[model samples]
Target chain A: MGGFFKSSIGRKVAMALSAFFLMFFLIIHLTVNMTSVFSADLFNELSHFMGTNPLVQFALQPVLLFGVVFHFVLGFILEWKNKKARKVTYFKNNGAANSTWMSRNMMYSGLVILAFLVIHFADFWVHEINVKYINVEPADPTRYYHELVEKFVPIWRVVAYSVAFILLGLHLGHGFTSAFQSMGSTAGRKRALQNLGKAYAVIIPLGFIIIALYHHFNHH
Target chain B: MKLKLKIWRQKNASAKGQMVDYDVSDISEHMSFLEMMDVLNEQLISKGEDPIAFDHDCREGICGMCSMYINGEAHGPDRGITTCQLHMRMFKDGDTITIEPFRAAAFPVIKDLVVDRSAFDRIQQAGGYISVNTSGNTQDANTIPISKHAADEAMDAATCIGCGACVATCKNSSAMLFVGAKVSQYALLPQGQIEAVDRVKNMVAQMDLEGFGNCTNTGACEIECPKGISLDTIARMNRELMKAHI
Candidate 1:
């Protein structure tokens, strides 16, 4: 273990494993979210079910939170170590011209995503738990679902969601391909991974964007 | 072809350095990169100015002493060839080339393009050798029939000239490639297996101790390597380290 930690391969493995864990969470989270686009009632019912579900609330919730925290912490640690290793700085350079813009700016995009998450949770998660919205009634639980859709229907809320989804897409585009490479996939598989990465980069963001637009236009 | 060269000049290790520009005309296209520098130096001496200080011995690209960051790339624009072997044809007439020493905290510039790469020597001294001595015929070379693949890999890793191009090209100035080459050279050979575990541990420790950065597998080292040392060596070193750790 000591040798592994000291070696470059060992560190890459650690990075890959953490990334895999986070990617798994992304898939599950996106699936749960897809329901909101199809039917607000179904989405609210699922959200309420998730909130009340003992298996998820007591077990999976803690695991998910731990995964997110671990992934974010490890990513930053690796970035910090990489920064310390760099010795010289270039002036007016184009070295990163070959790489994706998102790959180069992953840390910044992650920060944006984190900011969006805080706001998202405060609007939806806080209301779900605390019944804090003006129209939400604690005694009448079904009304909470109506209030949730009403909150998302606002033009500003839709715009925020669109911007957050765009950032998330950029993050996933680089994260997915990087995770695959870290796991020892090379050459032929790398091309396939990059293609899949591009697809997810478009589909995932578009999925969320469509959901936001649908809620904003049709319901309003 | 005449070219204007803005080269960094320093009197000593502690002296402040400045970019001193020189003009050298009628240069032959066939001259090696170092030869071009030699022409510039000859001109400076004739003019009564102190010649530029640089390091080069064996000019055959085997000694790893000739190191320079030419126009941002280590050892210049050509790939897989050292500064000594690089010809002047790669540059055109009237080009202003910028030459600087390999910049790294561990590799302080001594004078001009020369740097004290002895840190590499120290890391090697840390644990790069086997304890077995060859005073008397302890064992015949034929006694250990190594596999062809391992022997080839060992030879490839041994091809590393210990040139600091990997360090110069690396954004973090990580010496992972250099250390990885040293580790791989021995790790792949049967004679090196006896001390493989201790070898990697000590070398890696010394590498960090020398204030070198960690490797990020940016592939820049491989691109800028004068000898075309593969990144696979790094992977192999990583594998050996993993086995040792486990």
Candidate 2:
């Protein structure tokens, strides 16, 4: 309903729904990227399929992009509104006395993630788009693996990605259970869900980190 | 214990406020924080100076009228207690204590260390009650049997004192915990089911209209709450709101 999107709870639910979509996208992306560790042919095959498939490029890609933009725009708006709620500042607020550093500083962590996203898009997506659509270059399935490995060969790029992944871990550390809590989940399963969230936060980012580090070292 | 105090002082709602320092000596550690304030006021009155104004009714902590951001906390450094219940022993001799009003756009400072909490009352008035027929025949109270678990949880939600500590301590000044407690206390009961959808929708609408921030699930409210009201109540309210939409 139109009214639902206007309310605070409704807006929170909308944020949570977008977060869920983005989190799911991470898993698929990581799985595909992980294939590069084993065989170049397999990685190339998967990359070519994902990069050129009509369903992916034309349909799901736009939805994913929309979800990312929607999440960030709404997040910034909510942060701005929250800041306006308190006109006067507290002389001394001990926020750590009651809440986690990450929970309170979501906007900052999200900004870091946003910065990384730009670099990520520039390094890979823009190039992919140019190769496929703009330049209309001939399809070379083997080009995918070499390009990905080459990106990780630079130390600065590897370090930047590693730092971004660590912050991503921190972002998901709170955001995972937070998203569920926003969905109105009951307390009975809270402990289990939080544990699951912790594991996910660590594993997802660690997987990406290992892939980055592995490529940086093994690109002989 | 002898201590230095820095208290916020303002002439009126529109006046500029500043922290004024005062020294109180020969104080006993056993005295309640408010009693120490009383001593300070006594000293001020004898000096022909105006006493710092603050809010407190039931020193026993049930009235929810007592509010002070003491030393960067809602109710001093102690956990699960209001300002009136905080004892002087929490601070040491020669310690300088800082006291200020609860800061929120919705809770404007009226004078020295006192804020207008009428925003909470308005939110409650919006939809915090259930409809009951009382003209002729009233329904028997014992007719409905509620599970013990539900009854206890409802009672827990009912324990919110409306002290605004949750709002004061929250980084975003969000009042979700307070509104959530009000909504959950009723949504759990069959007596409250008839108006359930409207209750959540209206209360949330009023809460937003009052300039309270959206909850980011920081869990600060639950930790700072005197009643230890859980974040589950907030989740329940979210669920209720979602169900209402559906």
Candidate 3:
């Protein structure tokens, strides 16, 4: 297992598996975010449960953080090796002819997503942790509802979040089907996988953008 | 037919290569691309100029020796054929064809158009074979019954010529297609099951150690492959490697 992790395809599989974890988490995260538009009480109730639940906080949150760090670190490692793989580049490479722009620019898009993560975690996760641990504030059920409304009040934060989600869409445009392909899951139904990837690439990020926009306007 | 050629010229592995111009005339359409190069070489020799150097073994394209990045494509404009199998008919009169060796960090140019693809050989040496005993009474080859699908897939993988076309055309210069083909060939066969664990583990380790790029599912390798090796082999290899770890 250790040897496998050190191998090229092994590391790639690690990236894919980690990305899949994040992908699943995104769906859950988006669903949670979506509830804010409907009813604050319902959203706050769910957010309090997610926040206070020991299993969610201790186990699932660590796994999620590990996935993010592992995925990002492996991506950089792969990029480094990939760069070294071809010391001399082609004089006139027509890369667009061979692959989708999203597929080709994964590292760049991923870097953008990484930058987005800093802002995202800082706005929500860091605040939550600081309030809970350092500030030693008492548990508040409706805290998430107000936090969502408060965070998007800033035009800059809303736009930045919207742009990050767009970039996330670009990243997932290639990532969704690619994760399937990486794990050797898309054997025969390649076309279907590609279509599904496109849908996910579009719909999920659109959801994030809509969530941000909804909060932006609703709060303003 | 008259054709203008732009060929990369480099004396050795450490030498910098640049495109040099030459012309060949009175070329027959049926002559293979290598033969036209021979004609050009003959002309160069008569003039006491150095002839270009390239690699080739069987002109029939099975030897996996011929490699050229022609006018942008790995094996010229034609699909499903190596440089050796490409006929001059693909070219028209007054056409200018640019030819260069396969470029990758692992495949340094040995001279003119010949590159040292020993990195592939080292990768193969890592774990490309089955350890079934052949000297004495080994397990009867006919005793095992493999599914038709498995057999066909194995044969498909076994067809990889390893001409480095995948590495040459890929934006990352990835060798996953080549390594995948090799891995899939054995992974599908019953004879290969015994060593599957170590085979995938070691082979992949060697491939990474060779400084080859990662596969991003670009599909360039499948499209440009002379053998028409499917990208499925890469997926299968990934599956095999992942399973071995578990």
Candidate 4:
């Protein structure tokens, strides 16, 4: 396992494995967030249970945090090494002639996503921690839906969250297929996986955006 | 046909290089790309200036010595052929051509257009061959049989010409495609089963030590490879490495 972390493909495998973990988190996250539209009581109950569960707080949350940091830090390292590998730039480059716009600009999209993560943590994860652990606010299950609705009601926050989700979709579009390839998938299965990845890229982010818009318009 | 040429000129590996422009006229359209370059060098030599340097041998395209980045594409704009196989007809009269050496940290330029690809040689030396028994007690050759499918796959992989184009064309300077091809050629053969474990391990270690970057699966190397080396070999090599470790 130490040997796996030291090599290049090993680092790639790390990135893929971590990215898949994050992908799994996204599905469950979107599911939980969507329940607010149908019933605020159910959403708050689920959110409170998730927030207060000892297993989640002690085990899963730390793992999720580690996954995010590992994915981004490793991504930056790979980008840095890639840049150094070519000390000199080409007089001309036709990268678009060979790859798609999303495939070529993963770094830029990733940076955008990273920035969005800071805003997200600031508004949600950090706030949740402060309310639950720091200030020792009394448990209020109803606070969950109220806070979510309040955040999206602001037009600027709505636009910011919406844009971030769209960029996340674009990132996943290339990243999904690429992660599978890195892990040794080949041939027709590779193409099928790529198509499925594209669907995942569009649908998941769109789901997040829809949840935000749904709350924004129906916050009464 | 007349054409303007912008070729890279450098004194040595340490000296800074720049693109130098020149004019070559009345050239036959049927001339090979390297032959046209020869005409340019002849013009330079006649004018008492140093001629440009590039690598080419067995100009018929099998030697893998001709490495040129023409108009930003490895081995020129054509597909599945080395620069030596590209003809002057690909360019229109009065077109300006830009020629530079293959670029990568692992492949440093030796002169004007020649790059030292000895890093590839080193990586191959690490573990590209299999050991054989010649103690006069070897197994009978007639008794050993290789499946046709495996032989065909091995033949496909054995076609890699050791050109640095895959490395040069990769945005990350990744040599995975090249290493993958070499590893698969032997891994699929029955004679190669003896040292199969160490061959991949040692080769990957050497490739990493050479300062090359990781494979991001951009698919550029596959499309740009003159030999049509597939990305499948890279996955195979990864599987080979993992299986060895296990």
Best candidate, lDDT-wise? 2
- How many backbone overlaps does candidate 4 show? 0
RMSD of each: 4.0, 1.1, 3.1, 1.8
lDDT of each: 0.77, 0.92, 0.87, 0.89
lDDT score, candidate 2, position A18: 99
Tell me what TM-score chain A of model 4 achieves: 0.97
Off by over 4 Å in 4: B134-142
Residues A1-220, candidate 2, lDDT per residue (tens digit)?
A: 8999999889999999999999999999999989998888999999999898999989999999999999999999999999999988888788888889989888988999999999999989999989888998998989999999998998998999999998999999999999999999899999999999999999999999999999999984
- DockQ of each model vs. true complex: 0.34, 0.87, 0.55, 0.69
Which of the two, 2 or 4, has more lDDT? Answer: 2
Cα TM-score of candidate 4: 0.96
Q: Could you give the candidate ranking by lDDT, starting with the highest?
A: 2, 4, 3, 1
Q: Give the Å error, residue A167, model 2.
A: 0.8
lDDT of 1 by residue, B52-109 (tens): 8888999987988888878777888787888898899999999988888887878887
Q: lDDT tens string, model 2, B1-246?
A: 899999999989999999999999878999999999999999999999999999999899898888899888898889999988999888899999999999889899999989999999998998999888998898986899999999999999999999999999887788999999999999988998999999999999999999999899999889889998999999999999989989
lDDT of 1: 0.77
Q: What would the TM-scores of all predictions be?
A: 0.82, 0.98, 0.87, 0.96
Which sections of candidate 3 miss by over 4 Å?
A: A135-140, A150-159, A189-192, A217-220, B1-6, B21-32, B35-47, B87-98, B131-144
Residue B120 in model 1: lDDT? 94
